[model samples]
Target: MIYSGTYTAIKADVPEFFMRKFIKLERIRANRESIQKKLNKKWLTCGIFTCVAAIAMIGSYRYISGIVKVSSNVNGKELPIYCVQTDEKKVALSFDAAWGNDDTQRILDILKEHNVHVTFFMTGGWVESYPDDVKAIYEAGHDLGNHSQNHKNMSQLSDEEKTQELMSVHEKVKELTGVKMQLFRPPYGDYDNAVVLNARENGYYPIQWDVDSLDWKDYGTDSILNTVLNHKALGNGSIILCHNGAKYTADALDALLDGLKEKGYQVVPISQLIYKENYHMDVTGRQIPDAK
Candidate 1:
């Protein structure tokens, strides 16, 4: 038999009996909601922190990898970035052929007449423009260096872009000359750590000059010669920088060679100048082989 109670009693009993169950159910639901909320908050916080952390890491990597500038000098000078070697009296006469290949034959003729070998940094476009000139440079027993495909600043490019620029020229030169280029000089002497690593990865040594002829400025022959002769430090090994397209450079070439010869300095290709197995990057961004 069902036991009935007074309305007040039923009300009281209803709550008494079900209150604990209801309370327990409500507690469970509230606990679930609280846990869910907590989890949501935790997840949100974690996601935000993760994103912030990722951004910070990316920025730090870019800064350290030289992908972006972390600090600027007070004078706001764009930092020069090439590893330079200055220990040796040996100077490398490296010519950059970008604008005109027409005069390449004349330059080659002059070099041939001197019986002196010079390193030629040829752009892919230049190679394309003058296949015979590229051939002549290789066939003449001079060292060939990859000068990038488009003559763009390789340091400013992404790793992939840098690889493409380097590899394209390397492959093209190899195809044309049947010799893989083992040296690299960035166009305009612009390079950074990325360039250095990219060059190293590609089995090429980075080459930079200790003395610049400043022939690109169309400096007079006397000025160019004086710049090379006066500013050039004679030692066991050194790499001299000059452009092939400059008239003054072409004019200064014979004089510079003669002066170097007079100083008892042997002008040699960069490979022979350093003559070491390992290369190191200097503070000035110049790369030199570790002295054996």
Candidate 2:
């Protein structure tokens, strides 16, 4: 009986020991699975962070390069016809008429006496205030060019506004004089690429000046004469700027014409001086004839 009882106890102890060992092994496996999960999650987070940083770097590079391209384009900006490239001893004298009509007849008489015709860029208000002067200028055999309607800065206008500014004065001049003007000068000498391109699209040649008489300063007759005569930009194909509204432009007109003639420069209108077709403008805004 004693031996049988001892064998039974040993068998019972063996099964209990095996069951405890199996429980311990299961606990270890569970702990190992938890550690592996944590490691996988940490690695995934690091990978995501690295990818985000790389994407940010690429975006910054593109933005900086885009700025560089814009600046480069500005370097080669569009320009108007400041002058012409020609070997002829000819120049153009242009008068901007935005205000006043007191000296209009005097100017016409002086021009007729000199047998010289010049370009007159008139604003819409001027045309309205002095229709007879417009007719007088055209009748006297001069080029009537378009100065923007309201005398606003053309560079600041929208595309449609720019076209309106040009065509408004154009239609007014056309109706008054029965002349479709092909020349346009922006108010305040202000322009951008849109201004120039829109003018061309509307059948106009955008004009600017190389020689400024500074007659608008109302200094005196001698100042106007001295400025135009001694201007450094006075060379072949120079376009001179004057304002008829100035206090002394009419007074200085006769002497200025005589001075220009003495210098052996034939003062012609802008139409005769500029090349209408097959021409290109350089960076200095000089119109150049293309190779034949």
Most lDDT-accurate candidate = 2
CA RMSD of all predictions: 12.3, 13.3
Give model 1's TM-score versus the native structure.
Answer: 0.67
Model 2, residue 183: distance off in Å is 0.4
Score residue 266 of candidate 2 by CA lDDT: 98
The superposed Cα distance between candidate 1 and the true structure at residue 241, in angstroms, equals 0.9
**Alpha carbon lDDT at 188, candidate 2:** 92
Question: Which lDDT values do the candidates have, in the order given?
Answer: 0.73, 0.89
TM-score, predicted candidate 2 vs. hidden true structure: 0.74
lDDT of 1 by residue, 116-184 (tens): 898888889988888888898888989898888999988789999999998998888889889888888
Candidate 2 regions exceeding 4 Å error are: 1-75
What C-alpha lDDT, on a 0 to 100 scale, does residue 54 get in candidate 1?
Answer: 100
lDDT score for residue 131 of model 2: 92
Residue pairs of candidate 2 with colliding backbone atoms: none
